[model samples]
Target: MSSFDNTHITALTDLINKAVQDIIAEYASAGRAVPSLDTLESGLFQVPEETPARLTKAIQIVEAACAQLSCTVAPPGSVMINKSLEHEEPACLLVVTEARIADLLLDKPEGLPASELASRSGLDTRKLTRILRLLATKHCFKEVKPGVFANNRLSMKLLSSDTVSSIVCLLTDESLRASAYLNETLTDPSERDGGIPFIRATGYPFFDYHKTRQGLKKGERFPRAMVGWGDVTGKGLLAKVYPWTSQPANTTICDVGGGNGHVTMNLMKAHPHIKVVVQDQPQVIEMAQKFWAKEYPGAMEKERVQFIPFDFFKDAAVQGCDFYYIRSILRDWPDTESELILKNVRQAMKQGSRVIIHDTVLRDAVRTPESSSNASVHHDVAPEPLLPNYGVARVRTYELDMTMMNLLNSQMRTLPEFIELGKRCGLRFEKLYEVGETDLVEFSPI
Candidate 1:
């Protein structure tokens, strides 16, 4: 390699080595080994309540540097080809999840023949093998022996019992379907309304489409999908990071546009002293009532939690709650609608009341503190030889931004963009709490 190439590789390798050492030290201190990837009970997937910030930062460095090093050393043509055909992986994953192949293999530790899998899943033997083979290449499943397959740690995540399977299906089904029309929607001059891609593909906007008969069926699966999403996205860690225990007992939290109240349920479960008022659409609140009833019946019976129908765009959230928590809500709409929602929340805020918007804040491949005036919170920027946004380590945020575009023509905002939006709604940015993959941005009434 040339001197320039050597320099880049040295830096990237150094970053990787340091991060690995940090991770090893953490596990060693805890008297635990780093979780294995081969078994379903590895324990890595179950995120602990308190994830050390150092450990999270170390993992981010390892992911960013490794991907950067790969791109730097790999053949340019091969990299381009891999990127071009990347969509095929999700397609294969869809087949595995939809077929309930993981669940079928739950009791079969030894593995099963491709023919047996095909017989059970009702798929052609050869084609089914091809799909499994493709996914196995990605380490999502494993070929324990030639022509025999079994679920690995990754594949086990797709079991029908896992909420993540619902998310996998949602992405591969509706999100992928709408993504096919993204190009056409952008190019078509007559595609005026936002969500044109989803509308063109499904004949209705995201919310409206979900209300139709077909949408209702998909909607039934969506809440479970959100729970799965929260798990994978480290959203459940919000309860741990946000210091809910510091709030006085019985302090009220209004979950604005909180879907099915899964995130709030996590909070309530962790800190039983805090009360919650879960607000969403009528149908969603109805479902949420049933969810709370089954999960924590006393929360409803004692009036510690209330499920109320709310239209944030047209009406304010429950008035004067200690904290207004909105998770994964604003990203589904464009700026105009997002501003309206914030304004309404602002309308109901008391002097000490605060609004917490929990979502991913997008980062660029390169950034500097001086890049934006609204860069009030300091974010960790990757070192040289790695993309500043930590590349694939932070890929989920970018993927979610695209999902929003595919479904609703919305986006994950940058810090500056979020601040601007809040300013428009008479809310000022208070502070930002970095939980893990997502963030909790606090805002107070201006």
Candidate 2:
């Protein structure tokens, strides 16, 4: 009959106020305007920063409360029922992209008629009108005038040249295939033998499928899409969060499996004094070279960055770097392969060297509250009466965990699991830098 109890409501109020003040103060200090929901750019999420960890945690806590409380107050089927058809949003998007409707709308901010959009893209006018109307219902595109379309912030990402378009393409393409066969993959011997649903649906494991001459372009699209995903989702905040300057001057930091050096290049750009090595498979290394030369000419010209071909299982990691940094790398493999990769890094380390691992550390279903005395090592927990790990706010991480499972037969890991694996390679967990759902853990030589 009543809303949440006094304690829960009070906590939510405090968290909301704290987050508001902190965000305002953070921006004001930098002489910038704080974000607002009315503007699309401001409405986006960012990876949290330790400089304002308390503020970041406050934001996560209150947002989770908002979602949970809103739903809790409503009847079961009211808000929850429609989510069953969430896939239709993407299904509609597949049509938008295939027809390049977004591209056609890009220059027509005033809006272009559905008939003209159809003519340019070669779809039937009536069919294109229905599809755009479907998307416009969800605000993906705006119907500026009846039966006319234009790019709004949401639809802009689907433009032909936008990196986020690549992300949209990859997930819908991959996730749709995997979802269809996921049930079969679990019980069918042949499907299980294929290793994952992506393999079963597409006739190859995710990576191997990407490398086929046909797969090469889509394979490349996924990484570039990651760059966009990082931008939108706040995965790019590491350059600011990491204590890069703590290392001595001229220190070397090796980016293991650094695809196209997107993350590594950000680090090099931000911390100019450090040297970076971008290592990956030979093909990726070649691409990384071109990426650096094109985007960060100063890095190669000044000898501050190097690209080297590498295979983690077969060779020792680039030797004697002060730091070995792995971002979004280890989760692609299961523990056994993960161990071998770490052992290689272990062999490369000098006496005082460390490894910086940037990955999601899965939390317990029920967790020690962040306010608890025992929570120093725990990931952030949701306030009770909401799921402990924050329910839908954390949907993306769980989705990613499944993405790893579906494509690679791997997963996101727990901190204890990380500890167990680290012990096998003689490394000790040194510290955890918490920022939203992701944690950057430092590992030192045993």
The candidate that achieves the highest lDDT relative to the unseen native structure? 1
Best-fitting candidate, measured by TM-score?
1
- How does candidate 1 score on lDDT? 0.85
TM-score: model 1 vs. ground truth? 0.90
Q: Report the C-alpha displacement of residue 390, candidate 2, in angstroms.
A: 3.3
Give me the overall lDDT of model 2.
0.77
Q: Summarize candidate 2's per-residue lDDT along 209-262 as a digit string, tens digits.
A: 888987887887877778667755666577666677776788998999988888
Worst 10 residues of 2 by lDDT: 36-45
Off by over 4 Å in 2: 1-63, 77-80, 107-110, 189-193, 211-217, 293-302, 369-388, 435-437
TM-scores, all candidates, are 0.90, 0.83
Candidates' RMSD to native: 2.8, 4.0
Cα lDDT for residue 54, model 2?
53
